[model samples]
Target: MAAVELTVFQVILLFWSLRTAVSQVEMRCPSSCGNICIPYPFGMEEGSYLDERFKILCNSSSGVPKLTVDGTKLEVRDISVRRSTIGVMFPVVSANCGGKDRNTVVDLEGSPFVFSSENYFIARGCGNLALMNQNQSTIGVCVSICDKNRDSMMASCSGTDCCQTTIPSFLKVFNVTMKGLDDGKGSSGEKQCRYAYLVAQSWINYGSYYSDVGGDSDPYDMRHRDSVPVVLDWGIDERVFESLVKNGSFHNSSYSSTCQFLNPSINSTNQSSTVQCSCRPGFEGNPYRYGICEAGRAYDNYRRKIKAKMAGIGVGVGFGALFLLIGLWWLYKVFKRKRSEKLKKKYFKRNGGLLLQEQLSSGEVSVEKIKMFPSKELDKATDHYNVNRTLGQGGQGTVYKGMLADGKIVAVKKSKVIDEGNLRQFINEVVLLSQINHRNVVKLLGCCLETELPLLVYEFIPNGTLYQFLHDPNEEFPLTWEMRLRIAAEVAGALFYLHSAASLPIFHRDIKSTNILLDEKYRAKVADFGTSRSVSIDQTHVTTQVQGTFGYLDPEYFQSSQFTDKSDVYSFGVVLVELLTGQKAISFKRSEEQGRSLATYFIMAMESNCLFDILDPQVVKQGEREDVLMVASLARSCLRLNGKERPTMKEVTMVLERIKKSENLTVQQESEYDRKEVMGAPWDVTSASTISSFDIGAPSSLDEKPLLHTY
Candidate 1:
């Protein structure tokens, strides 16, 4: 019957389609996985390609498939069958600069094996500041620093935890030098060591090359040193590449539909760079995966299942049949999602995120205490971190309060600037902060980096700043004497931990009253670590660009372009002066004698035995004259002219703790203290100029809304 003939015809069509799908020509991979095919010029070796230009090699030591450049095992995070070539992450380079005392050099040689011009180059860190020579020439370079550490934000690089800069386009290989500006974080080791290196942009996730590389990271067991991963781009000539992908390969059932090759030019040329390809609609696989069309996109267990369904439907419905159209649509979507996820995984690994996790655990850190949030989750939590939701802001970024899925409250600090240089520094801060578990320091709960600007999630502190109480008269308050002393003692203890107890040494270069945060219970929480510098005990401070808040910055360190633990001491001394007099650090007001320098003023007051004359009346009323005098003496000592003469944070902490204990005992004896009744004079804050004399332009106020959406 006619119906029987129709079924037979359908069978014939189905057979033809299957034949077309399987009859694909053998296309080589860029390289090989064992004996398996690695199509075209990207062969296992030179002979595998038309010329040596596209040569590739395998590394058996990888245990699984891996690609290498010249013999260096280039960690192939992924190979896109859709987009030819692969993503090979390189090790990151960190620079440690001594002050401008000498012209020391740290050579970076990625010589013969050139990075791809099509992709990007990234650099990161403070201390390791330099200008890079891309393609053997000065393309561009950046210098980053953080003035204060211990605040959740505020560092030399930005007001945030880290800073970043992007590499120039078309860079093949690069070099670094300390020519343009000098790094002074290496204040102590000014003679011998300084750091600099060229890194692939991919290696630095954010806040990458932190100075605290010694006992806090992967190379901790060894002597003090820090290394990070970097990424680079690669490509073959565009024309040949196009032919390889768009030749009589996939979808060209007939030779007529295949592309025609162009005649070679009448010149000596390998013609490798100018190649690309084409494909038909509803198709998304390499044109030369098998050197021709193949049955599936990327082959894996999951894809096999989808292919099986496709094949089964092909077997039953035949070609040109809409009978299984609905199933096809859904399958396509699933396939696309899987492909995207695979790419993300590839980027994640290439970014060394996986390695970081491994290292954190090996270092005996409780990795579970830290969480990695998906980019989208954070976007929603803060209204995509809307400007309206931002409660405060600073140099590197902005802060918005967010609620996580676990019902945890957090303050999300988001950066406005994102580039290659600070990318790694950002990642480094995240890793370092995640490992630290301090009660007095604001906790770094988690982070999200997939977004353009980085976002750090911290336990939110609702009480605002110790500055607000000392200065702002919002009727919301003036801190009580007990509250002030407790805050000072707690902050001192935290600083002590940063100096000696923590695994690595952290220097808070820009310490000030505003940077000190208070919790709802009035407990002190030392916030911001952006301008902080970490140094190994063996190494001196790294030379860095002059960076820090104007009034709170160390005068000796700034002039000398050097940094030290004592640098933090000098800055903290300025903070003490604020507490004693309720005065700003660098006010343009008051008599010259009172305003010459807070340090000078305090010293003069102490030497003249006029300490009581300058003490905040509220402070004097709240404590006995002897107790007030005792605290004032300590403050004066903290403001010593010589950094070496200033007390160590540990010693400072002991002194303050003794004072706190004595004050608390007195409160207990009196048993009639009322926190709500008495208060100090309204704080005479010497509001710092928003623009430091060194900065290019005025940065946005930390309290105003951001120019862009917080999201």
Candidate 2:
């Protein structure tokens, strides 16, 4: 009788699976266009897609069916419902050998599609420099150098006759322009036609697709096949679903029943709002269509098999089920612990633990100086990164105040989500900071990589940043003229050491007042080395993506994307201006005529002979007039639009030191003169004359030949 009841239950389960499958089949809509599967959110027919923008068109006029986006010639190659991506054939922008250069513009401004970062901006042809622009700004650039040998020219896309760079995420409009370098020469000694386009990154891994050509051959041979596969990310805004529900297009219940909404994440690159959706787990088919997503066939088969097996052994298993469950639970706990440890190891490896270990072994990074803290220790110290312990947050990560097991206080920097491409930079910060042993630079205590996000441990700085002290003054600890001057000297000394005194020349690319942390003594300690880069002794500058605070960024570096030691000088110059004026680097509180840039405002004030008008009240009141003018002049020289004209950090450091020494001498003279009067001793005429002459000559000497003149 028990066996008969088990068989009945199995039959009922099979019936339910069949009913579910039949219902899915009945609800299925037109699901294909050409060979591409038209998922519900994207369809080739009316009432099948989520909206009009999701519509696709099928054309079979040429004896071969092709799927295209509605009202556009762009052909759809593949659709990924799960990843919310689509592969499309995009035209390659070609520049003819001698004809006017051609540029390709793909506008998806109002659509739900964005050029995925997985696509590479590829440029083919020797002596070609390709630029991908958005809103008239160069976002991506690659240069292909000429290779004399024809065989070597077509070998790879490693900047020899071909080059590629990753595109930015959330890129809706792609504009590619290719320019010839050195008269567009190629291996054949003629202007070769260049091809530039956005292609799916995976497609390039398949191998070389371009054919070698002779000198006399037509440069437009690849014109016959004009398009390359490009990947595009697609997503619908959550507001669209809310609008649909309000307009009675779909019931609120149908939303989650068909499609699962993903957790919204802020895309810092574009600041655009887009929400992704996919079919619920265990279901397959059109997620945007109600009742269309059903249990996968494989899942249904597995269920059927499980029911059959259970029917055969149900009575025997029931007698020992409780003991088996308890035993299984114990095994699961052990398995889970092992899995957790394995996952931590995986994260550590992924975060470049092996590379760091190699550096340590190779003596590139001193092993004795840096430690690798356990994730659990940091977690406990920061109270599991509680909000109350949060020190500060920035574009790269958040800093939390924490205490170690040894009763030592530290700052824990928890980085934001980092992709594989940026892992090198993350490890780079570790290596760079480990090599640095300067007193004015924040010390790297260690790092913990056995967590989801890498954590950097740094020496805690009690006093906040120079920016806060300058802009938001604390009555208890006012940034007096002496303190500001001392802080300036300390920061300049640190930068000079980085530029000329370090084992390897390091560039603090993101130098700003905010990055300048103050210690308990109000001395400057340059912090935040995440964006710093070290270069070889012979290298003058590093050509890279433009990065820095807007107003503090070197104009020359911004225009050319070449960061030099002088670029740091330019940023430091802005900090100097901030110290003098006590104004934000980029502020709208000033007049439009000043252009809202503190550097520009300061320069204008100096040029107009109104330097004291915009000077910080504290600086003007306590600072010596000659010394203030001298420092102002030094700052102006550093802020020169031309990088070459700016004084080197070493030069700036010397000028500051000279100014400080002169102030010290003046203070000593006044102290000695007061002591003589207090004791009623006979004043030495030579000493009084010496003091008078020194005071009289100092300002004139500084004005006639500025201290920065040596640079």
Candidate 3:
């Protein structure tokens, strides 16, 4: 009787503990809000929440309760505990006819919340450019053209009548501005209203805009929709997790919970780091609650089966069944792995992986430096190369932003499928780029060939291309003369290094402003080596098909089909012209006499002694007359009719460096003079002196000789 009672007590105690663990999630918390069940980590009342960030306010003023973010008053549509995101009905802005234009700005700074990466900046209506900006810098821009065929807009926010672009994560604040590209009239012959908003990825589909209206009608109703759902991410401070984990106290604090550090390279408003808490593998529940993680249904069922087998049969029979089950599981895993390997091998051969291996082994490329990544790993890093992960797209391919397993952010280039003629050239690029290393050149991190088409990974650059800074009117800061000069010198130096410093001479046939990237400090990084060529020591030039941008292409190369190192000089000269004049390399808007080519117009202006007439006002204001003339003269020399007449990249690099040093010295002297005046001047005289300094600092036209005569 005593043994039976003891056994019964032990069984009861185990059952009570299990029940308590599962019930912990709802203890002292309001489990429901209206019709929705509130989960752990997210609570309606004060004491139930793990922290203030988890507080979900229920507004009952209208006789019906509605969920809102605590203190923000932003209405919440839904909460996703698994995704670590919240769906909120964010307001959308519109520029409509017969009504005032509205700009919707969402500022999330100083809050623990951030915009989710899965969200997109979407714009609706035809002939509009939607711009999203933060901290006076443009984040994303999308242009919508007038489309009479609204069928395309019905399916997705395709770049026809509607446009969409993915926003980067860790964005605390952003403002949406919509401007008309047409004369305020859409292709539907209506006074089109532009609507722009931030919305969740899942909520968008074909029927969102054009279901009611066929290909001819307007969707905005001329009044604009009030709001749409957008996703926001939340996380805990990393310091707390680090402190608890390091002291071995985390295990005691929470059972079946794991700490996952957010990618360090991701942008964040928080001063410290952030981390996410998740239920351990084989368990599922809210990890924010203590001891709430429960075993998965499959695991619980398996345990019950084992207990039943042990109770009903002999120990030997039960053991034999368990061993057989384990053997079957092992075999299944082996078969799955073998199948995966066979697929990888098949893809490798199809993507010219064997040819790449042969080339790398020939001693041209350093195998250690140039990694060959598995396709699976890249797919995981880039979320299976989803369109939302795209960084930029060009003629060669699209570049997607990805985070490696080692926590490095990279730009993965997914090239379009190529014909057999281009296969050798693609492999050649990998070998050449892997061997060359220069500061201004984009660094190739690795490549992956285990797919139908190859992928190349390069270090991610944050700031946009030089063309954007020059051409984008929404750009907050104007490109200064000093910055342009420095960039010119940097680009010239990079080209020189490619030609002379590398083992084999390399010609960057696609040397244009668009291919040049700018870092945070505005340092130039020459990129896009898709059309580059590497010649052997004995070769002077490679005669190939005419391949280059029209305005920047060398006349000699275009006429003769021969590409020499000087061909790059002509392209570089065009970039220099763009820097001097803020005009595009090619523009159809220019008059017939002005010529389509910026180089031709610039030369004509110089010959006519009207160089200053076409120069950028910013450059004219900041640049010294002599420095401007010297750069113009160098550009003219580079744009010579004959390739042989063009100055070598080495000589061009030397002149630009000299000019940069001279400018630096002049700036230093001016700064010193200003400092002395500030230190020595009386309070009354200071203001007067500052005003006089500005008056005296203006450039004089008489400071240099004629640009045509100078060269």
Candidate 4:
């Protein structure tokens, strides 16, 4: 009776699986156009269609299948099920070569498809201008110019013989037209055809489809004749998924399928919400079919065979052997646990955990101040160091967001290098940060040493870095002039404390806008002390390898390999310039004459009496002219080529503080006061006769010797 029941159950299971597979096949569209498979949701036959937009018409009158979208007769080259895009060929218009001027217009209005952002409007020909218009409004124009006598060299659409520009995203329709220059004249008296169309970046960049020249050798000639692949993004309303789920539809029927919401355009509405579906992670099959999320067939069959053998063994005197094997496994686990613990202790010692304990015990360092967390605790907190928990990355190492057992959020810094030198620095950071107490500095909570690389835990900063606030377009709130001034003052104060008021004189070698973080209140928090050096009271400066960001590095220290308090001041001066201009430390978009550093451009502007030209408009409007000039002048003195001419961090902090307080002071009075107090002050760098008061201008001093820029 038992054997009969088991057989009956097995038969039922087999029947159910077979029934599900057959139903899935029937629901899915198995039709094809030549070699291209028309999957479900996209159908070539009326019975296989799920909607009118998905209907693909196939013409086979010529004995070759050609697919058209929605009976529009536009040939479909290929379809992408994963990316939710289709490649179609569009007509291209040309001039000068006398090709028929068929101005191509791709009209996709009221359709589920839009022009993908991955395509570019490109025009290939000299002495021609390509104009792209949308909704009868001119959107962009690209002109290519070439000398008649010069040899033509094809470039990658960089405004040379071929000119290209990016099209707007979410564009539903566009018209491409070309105009010939100088009465339809061609380059070098040879008729050149101008081709303009929207083409996929991948296809154009591949460069494998160019036509054979046959000694004619026009680079713009296309091998595929009048057709080029154009990519279109397709999406449908999210309600489709809900309907499928509620009605038990086969479309996206797999259990391991997920839906993604598309980025809606400004004109998107509830009736036209866009969504897409794809197979979930670790599953690869047709998402529109039942049982689509199953693992590979080979693995499933192997597992079944192994299970059958195990069942037979269990029914025939294998219980005793199984019990013995379980006992051995338990012993092996215990041995492995002990070995792991031993290795953890070894790593702890190697990472200076023992030395830290010794220092605490001897009263050389405070006791029970910095916690030493176990490796397992940190690993669990960070979910085995998942990439999703990553807060940010830098040249030093990666930082991950972690939650402690006590429900406290923290930042876990994982250093990349484990060299002897870096190990010492890591230990030093622990020691210094444990004793250091400052509200504007990031707090060191604890550390974990069991891992190959040491991990440092710091108090989590809620807001992003100042760089994001200054440059990121998506930042909800703009950095106002008042806020920038306050932030500048706060960072200057922090640096002042580090340079003069800390337990030891610490020099922050790297000080830029990026290194400065903002907290919940938008207050500045100076961070990243990996390259900081501590100096003794008797020592004037430290001579070591120069290390800092390219645009912010102090030119004097960069050329001398000698770092001092003034070096940090120079970097901070660059930060001051950043705050003033709202520009990056190194900007590639600026004109070639400006050089890479904003400091150089700012200095030029100040020298040329065009300070307002480069000042942030916000700063100009909110700040008084005299105040803006004062701050600009202060930044200029800080950025002086001579280290001695730069004001100290203390002076910078005082000036920013005074500027913030003197907002109500009249311009006349302010100018008079500046002339009286700051006339002979070291901050004055306008005239060449200003003398250095800090003895930094002498060549014999290491503080004045310029360093080489090379590492």
lDDT of 4 by residue, 566-653 (tens): 7888898899888888899898899879767798888777766677888777898888777776677677767877776567787778
Which model, 2 or 4, shows the larger lDDT? 2
Q: In model 2, which regions exceed 4 Å deviation?
A: 1-333, 361-369, 666-711
Q: Any residue pairs clashing in model 3, and if so which?
A: none
TM-score for each predicted model, relative to the true structure: 0.45, 0.49, 0.50, 0.57
Over the full model, what C-alpha lDDT does candidate 1 score relative to the true structure?
A: 0.56
Best by TM-score: 4
TM-score for predicted model 4 compared with the true structure:
0.57
What is the C-alpha lDDT profile of model 2 across 492-597, one tens digit per residue? Answer: 9999999989888999999999999998888899989888999989888898998888999988888778888888998999999899889999999999897699
Candidate 4: residue pairs that collide: 559-706, 559-707, 559-708, 560-706, 560-707
Name model 3 segments beyond 4 Å from true. 1-332, 364-368, 664-711
lDDT-sorted candidate list, best first: 2, 3, 4, 1
Give the range of the ten consecutive residues with the poorest summed lDDT in model 4: 689-698
lDDT of 3 by residue, 487-590 (tens): 99999999999888888899888898889998778889999888888888767778899998989998888877888887898999999999999999999999
Error of 2 at 589 (Å): 1.3
